[model samples]
Target chain A: IIGMMAMTLSSVAADHLPSWNEGATKRAIIEFVENVTEEGSPGFVPPSERIAVFDNDGTLWSEAPLPFQAAFAFDEVKRRVPTEPALAADPMVKAMLDGDIGKLLEGKHHDGLMRILALTHAGMTTDEFDRRVNQWAESASHPRFKRPYLELTYQPMQELLDYLRSHQFECFIVSGGGADFMRVWSERVYEIPPQNVVGSTAQVRYEMRDGKPVLIKTLDQLFVDDKEGKPVGIHQFIGRRPIACFGNSDGDQAMLEYTTIGNPHPSFGLIVHHTDAEREYAYDEKPPASGKLTTALEAAAARGWTVVDMKRDWNQIWSNPDAASN
Target chain B: IIGMMAMTLSSVAADHLPSWNEGATKRAIIEFVENVTEEGSPGFVPPSERIAVFDNDGTLWSEAPLPFQAAFAFDEVKRRVPTEPALAADPMVKAMLDGDIGKLLEGKHHDGLMRILALTHAGMTTDEFDRRVNQWAESASHPRFKRPYLELTYQPMQELLDYLRSHQFECFIVSGGGADFMRVWSERVYEIPPQNVVGSTAQVRYEMRDGKPVLIKTLDQLFVDDKEGKPVGIHQFIGRRPIACFGNSDGDQAMLEYTTIGNPHPSFGLIVHHTDAEREYAYDEKPPASGKLTTALEAAAARGWTVVDMKRDWNQIWSNPDAASN
Candidate 1:
């Protein structure tokens, strides 16, 4: 009995974390956690004072050619094209349907993609849109990876999130994707439920439908969840400055800037630079699709943000043990 | 040298928070940490999975008689009343000026309060309003407590926030007060900075003035942050469901409900019940300015939410230990 109890306690302690691979990322993470959590450590942050924010797309998961939501949108458009045969020939719709994601985004600025999103996503009820997104996510596979898009999530990132939470870090997903679309699977995938996800949204209208009140989407623009809008989104949604923030694109610059501003104790701001082409496609300055990552890199380096070199830091790419098995 | 080494090691272990008061609250908290953190724990949650949300008004501080912002409004109105003497003769204004908070709220519901808030808070430029709120907050004292209104914040709650944070909990303040107003001081009081505070607000218009664009508030109603609105606000702002929630009124019931709904793991909801009549005024099921405790109490009991009896559980009240001392 004594031996069993000892083993159980040791196992519990050992299981708290399999030791992290040694490197700057591990050191940074451990140092940050220790400073914030260890009471007498120079960086000892009180629990009430602990606040960490994360970007949803590239930082948390994969935002390769496009954000996962954009990919979902493309899949959705493809599925719905049969219902609207004219979309088969429509250049914009054709590009999406044919999976010519790069072509659809070719030479288009961020505003152009927003315009496409507005046209593609607007006029549908929030519920209908959510249902379509769920259906696509369930069935769709990434063209390059040949894995379900959800499986494309970065493994090391997942470990980091779990690590932070264990220490009392409140994590949040600040993204430029549609809030409704992200909310559906975030809880299951990231363990972040719908209420903790902040993203871009169209204005919603509260109306009576058959004597029942429902919040429906409208064509009117509410707020974009990118670039300068990121700070505003954090202000409007989370309502508190994050002591720590993580992101992978220029869109997250404002959020990182805002997070680091005037924080009294030690704070952290990390940028996940996609430097791995084999495990994951590597591109920066310009994304493969409509996503851009210029301003954040410039600001990150100047501001001393921790730029994560994926090729160097991570031994594992995705969470599936199958990746290693293969 | 050996004794000193032992002392240092003991201090390190002691600093790990093993000495927190032993009980359900401590156990629940520690168990949650272990589950989310300890890889072998049945509830072992990953780092990507750690997202926590908190209610601001009563959970983080005190919202007795009226919310802190409401008190700020009252004081602002009283200060400005001298500039508008003609309005001082008005019954509502007279009641406000006389410090008859009860009479001012007599027969007035939430709509009535909104009307007063609109009339008093709107029309002013955003900067003007913010300055006034800050000025009032700096000077105003609670009627009964006679402490700077902000100083009325509960110390134990602050400790709780720190405790959770030390464990890596991401804390936020979701309140029914104005977002801007709360943002001003929430950072200083709760250590939850401006970006994490979500609340009600008047519509803001973005425009250029003196060659620079600024967002200005309009009298138009934007959003309410109470009752059903709490959940809506959470959806619009935080965008993810919280694992833990805390509140003290009906306004927070929806938030708690939303937080616990369909959550599989051990989620927590806590209601701070003001039961001390001598140290703090106590009333439940009363109307108009009476602190909201009735619906919350029943719902909490039914849902197995933790109901904190202030008189019994708390060894201390308010951050200012010298208030009663003085």
Candidate 2:
């Protein structure tokens, strides 16, 4: 009877992975979950040790046209240039106003992009920034989808998050996006609490202003939680190695490697390959805007990582595909 | 009937706060817990926002001889000096070897202390560092207490932690100590998980070494979680404002202020005053080592923060005061 219950519980088509089609990618994910969560299995991990990490932009939500955070910074720069005409002196400001992503992402560190971000995101009280983000999120909609960026999150990934959480896996969003930016709506949109977010951080100082403590976000010491920084951020924030890793770009390659490679516990790694051009935007050869999945996508096969061909594996795209209601 | 049960559950003389004597301090703590945990009360806080932060060193355990991390670093520096004789060239290393607390704590940022920490704590893989901490903890005993450091945790404070946790409060150790040091044994000792620890962090870099992903602990970005840095660390790591703050010394003053003042929720702040010389070490005019509770103590009355007079308030000290069994 116990065995029957366990079998019934572990089935792939048991309404657990509804957004996920009956395919190898889904099977691989379910098999790994079962192996780690089943009681007394050789690969069984205690709930406390079960950590799963996800990249935000391309992995959890839509990044096309432009990543939501980049769009926010760009929009902010465009808004600020008129009032602070001095900001127009920088070529980055012009690039931002024109929505020239290629020019913004040119430099190695993306210095132009960072400059625009500094102008918009820093030199303000944390509360003010939070309020701004909250207000912006309410008004901002995706260019293509014509829905709030929060509503554009991948349905399959959200279901995966729920499924993993049901088995007691602590899910953390390890993203290149600013921690402050993502924290504004991560709880409401993703069910991921603010504390669980590991992202890029700015040099924020604590000050007592008018008998009130305020965190002042400064324009210095930006810790970009991208590429190699992902694992470093995970170490600094989470203080443990994640057993499961999910990502969509070359930026997340290090995180995936850190989570699965040579881990003592049974580990799982998945890559979301943007192959759905109809329902969602997809590229022929390379991801145009943000997630250029070259080296990581190539290395996934040898590493035994499950690569989800979005068109083939996912039955649905966004949770609220119809943009109007959402 | 519900009120009777609630009254019965909240009484200070009950089994919950057994280590605490019948006094105003105990009643105050119990009252705050009752107010926050009781549903439908004006002071009732949702479980998700019931974040209670504790300072690790003086608040949780003894820090008389030196902080545990400093002790670890000093010991490590001594161990390394034998192999690398050039390490003695640095004056800070000499001060560490001599255990001269005055010399170490002289500078503004405690430069000598930070130097010793960098020499011992950095330029190694995180895994190697964890192994060293585990090994050191097994053998390292307090000089005066003559017990393994972990056993020296205050029984009363431990009870407070357990009590708060029982009432659905998520407890975090926001300490002036190194995060890595606390993370190793926090769960076994204080029941605070590694993820819940907010402390000083060193710049760690992610690198691939021989087909394995490893985090290299670098000495560069040292975030000192002391004085004003405490609230900044909390903001960066926890990403939320705590409602309850438990701490000792001026290092915790900002944290207390941040937790209590201007907070929308009814907040609780407690200061652990080391007033017992026989049961525990106490200083008359000035604290001899680590915890110098001057500024914060003076301000506590106006802030309505509870001050625990250790000698008068507590009937017990260490959980395992007897060294041999523990």
Candidate 3:
């Protein structure tokens, strides 16, 4: 039964990355994968060296209407506020409830996010936290899409991940999202296993509870896997330099630079440009505050990075290709 | 050619591990590997999930006459002091030069070590750091063994690693040593690649130097992958629960407990008790404070973790099998 299913999936992957249009981005990706995996080719990278990384937000899924993680945090504050009256009175909690991103952004956006995240995400054991995240991911829906947040992942990117893995490449998500949060649903949603998921993390302490060992997430920020931290995170977690990196936003520029710049191997960098406002939210080139893509978008051409035009490069953005109502 | 070489290596691994004596230790190891790998057996673990973690110092290679890393740091201070005279005047540098382990151990041994380590290990680009570590490993020798420190690796452990790899197990080095330090020669010496190594790390910064992207190692300690932190490091890096863990110190007790204690699947833990003073230094059970083995030694029998008596379990320790003269 498993063999039959494997064969069917293999057939689907052979030629039809159904969500991707037969354009420059798709062709370039396929060419790079082929060059690296072909045995006799000069660019051939051994299977052991075939590491590819992808950013989670914007690149893999819709980050608009706020990132899923931020949304989760907002809901968490509401849920826990009833029991912890002190938390309800906190400035960050008040700001979150008021839907004030501008106020939160006033003084160190990261600090404000951490304040709310510490309250919402920490104190619980990893197992308990994982269970909560799993339940939340299953139930939570994107306000704009009205579908589960997991279902909002890019179909083309999913196909790309599948394609890379089939060619003996190890695919990893090097996201700025909470590592524990992403680990909960990454495997089921992206076909990328927990081990392959690397992300921003909170400090955790090992403790004994009722004679059983547990890791309690702490309020402290351990590592922020974003911007300059992206390359550092990659080196810290993955160890080996990735040959290819897929990302969107200025936050991923350092990672893209670190992956491709001066790497002796035949490498590739890709930028997912949100140009299709009709299909999805387009704010990168002209953003209110977040994910300003002006620099990376312009630099992509000179760097030889393939800029993925969502309006043109993707045949369909989502699995269900029907026009998204927003 | 590659196929023939693989076949030649496979034939050597078919029978006994050359460095291991025919005993319960050897038999138990083989038995566990066989049971876990056997198809249709309840103990079977899929190849993807067959993760095995090994501690580096003492377990894989000799850590006696001071760990190779510590020795390297001392040498680095001496080498760099000529160029940077300020480092020569530092308290830790003075302590190291005077061979004052007592001064280093007073109050905070870890902080002292970090001071010297930061002076020696950080500030360079990761690529430059890797190059330096590789050079040091190549030239450095054990004081008593009078051989390159890399040559001090236990042949039995090497065979075991190969044995696990042959059985489709993904072997990882979960060490308390510096991650960048180990990543230098781990692949060449242990067949464990950079990505497969999880270790203590200093914080690093991503920057552009002369138009080239580089990761600059910082003075701040990111993590100490020892004691309770071993399990935390394993969880953060590997993400998967290891089915088997090997170590030689009390520092590894938490990792073993985490790997085997609550795991539903069949698991194995092995402790290498350094009993052969003639072959290698024996200090675990009676230590000058590093890697004290009393608690773990007592707990091993009850937990069913195989304790390999170095004096009895192995016919030979090194690959050469010749008795060494100081």
Candidate 4:
């Protein structure tokens, strides 16, 4: 009996994903990686084509209360409003400070949102913007989690990143959030470097400022890396289709389809169904946030995509391995 | 005497860049690469940060007798005119076929050019676009060289790419040409993969056509990655500042400035001056094409950028090692 127990313990210990429960979902991920990396396997992928794309937001970390980038922008508004009374007086700025999503979601919210975006995200040089993002990342905490926002990243996903990378796979974060904002801290938080980030971009112009060339971020939106744009973004930035894709919401549906469907090579598509209300917010059938999963959830079964039930599949969510036991 | 002769022959054989003459340009390149890659050196750059950006048109290949892309577009016009009578009658189409660049250069040329671009480049899915580009690359030949356009690439530049890669440096082509156009054959021609190529992009729209999702190229001018836009393109695509930059014209001046000017790490910037009219077309001081290098030529010396004199510095221009002897 002791020998059997020891063998089980050793098997569990050998598992790369400690935060993940040993089940079909975890097995699928491991099997896919192993199959692709095996030298003589028919599905063996070369290191150059061993590309994996992951969505940020709810997939990598908690997006409850609001998207982290939105919170960052709101904080920026509040920080700057003290010096600029006029900005404070603006209805949009007030709505942002109060965390009133309803007001910001109204028909005129786009104009207000654009104003907020321009005020918070533009006018600064790229270097200055990067510095600001880094500073924010260093100090900011998730309101609900009461931990640094960076620490809220899913431990299972982190393990997966490390695992794939160890197998010579190049990992990339293809998010709908601000590219620059994610790039600033992605290296430290996720081990994914700045060059591997693909996200929404604002227009940045090159100009001579004080006889030195500077890239000034303009208010104009360049590209939004969400929904169908995800595949487009992947193509535009990476120039190759990802064989493995990890995403959570409906925004990632097209990306999943694009990755697994019609691809000549074997591919893997996994969706994290946030079902553990205790560990993470549960919102799959109907989400309050933009990452709705109705269509993707419905199609997941048909497409043979592995839908990870967060409650059952993840032994722990955050970095704390003992969270589930607690 | 025989021993001395053998030692001299071995020393000459040890040269990594046989196409490059013994000069400051060659020495500086070797020194920078070696210094940055040396373990524990103060100027040592990690493999990830050893990014080098090179311009395509004049730096990598011959751009004389009009740009290769422009020639391809002209051929496209000629090929399609038979199918569409109205297109044949179009003034821009007529001008393109006639080789009357002056007419196309007039103020009204913008509309005609846009029309031609739309006809030749857009209204196809990105996959279709890639296929078309690949087909063009296979069939197209340079008017001056009477060889495939791909063969016109500089032998010295090719060696430089190989050398940089051998030193663990990631090389990218940041060109003013079309990204899709270059991506088709960049891997085979330059050994730079699709993801590493950043260039001008046409607006691509995502749409479902007959139950299949596809990215369709639109006629709109999305981004012009020339002059000021080069840096912006690099930022959007690479997301990291390159350590080394190479270009041959004013169009790449901003990119070189952005790469080496304010970078914290030790950087190298090089400009290839086309001074060999006999081998390749010389057009540095006062050239015909848009890659004019007057201001950048003046700034190169002040900025400590190595200006490669193609005539004097290159022992051979083409891929044939014995082309110079011939």
Model number with the top TM-score: 2
**Candidate 1 lDDT, tens digit per residue, A72-102?**
7666666767887765667777565565656
Report residue A100 deviation for candidate 1 (angstroms). Answer: 8.0
TM-scores for the candidates: 0.62, 0.94, 0.89, 0.91
Better of 1 and 4 by lDDT: 4
- Candidate 4 TM-score, true structure as reference: 0.91
Model 1 misplaced stretches (Cα beyond 4 Å): A1-21, A84-116, A119-128, A207-213, A219-221, A299-301, A321-326, B1-139, B142-175, B183-197, B201-222, B226-231, B238-326
Candidate 4 lDDT, tens digit per residue, B114-180? Answer: 6677788888888887887767766877776777777788888888888888778999999999887
CA displacement after TM-score superposition, residue A81 of candidate 4 (Å): 2.9
DockQ of each: 0.16, 0.77, 0.50, 0.47
Give the candidate order by descending TM-score: 2, 4, 3, 1
Query: Fraction of true inter-chain Cα contacts (below 8 Å) kept per model?
Result: 0.27, 0.73, 0.58, 0.52
Query: On residues A33-151, what C-alpha lDDT tens digit does candidate 4 reach at each position?
Result: 86787676679898878889999998998888778888788878877788999989998888878877677777744676776877878889998988877777777888888887777
How much is the lDDT of residue A249 in candidate 1? 83
State how far residue B70 of model 4 sits from its true place (Å): 1.5
lDDT of 3 by residue, A154-214 (tens): 8888788878888888999999888888887777787677778889875678877776677
Tens digits of lDDT, candidate 2, A1-326: 76886788677434778989887998898889888998877899998899999999989998997789977877677666787878888888887777676787797988877778888888899999998887778788888778887788998998898899988999999999999899988888888888999999976888999999999998666788999999999999989999999999999999999998989999999999998889997852477578998889889999988999999999899885432132
Off by over 4 Å in 2: A11-13, A78-91, A100-109, A320-326, B11-13, B88-92, B98-111, B320-326
Q: How are the candidates ranked when ordered by DockQ, highest leading?
A: 2, 3, 4, 1
Kindly report which residue stretches of model 3 are placed more than 4 angstroms away from their true locations once superposed.
A1-16, A80-91, A109-112, A287-290, A319-326, B1-18, B81-94, B109-112, B319-326
Cα lDDT for residue A131, candidate 3: 85
Cα RMSD, model 2: 2.7
Residue pair clashes in candidate 3:
none
Residues B184-213 of candidate 3: C-alpha lDDT, one tens digit per residue: 878878878888899998678888888879
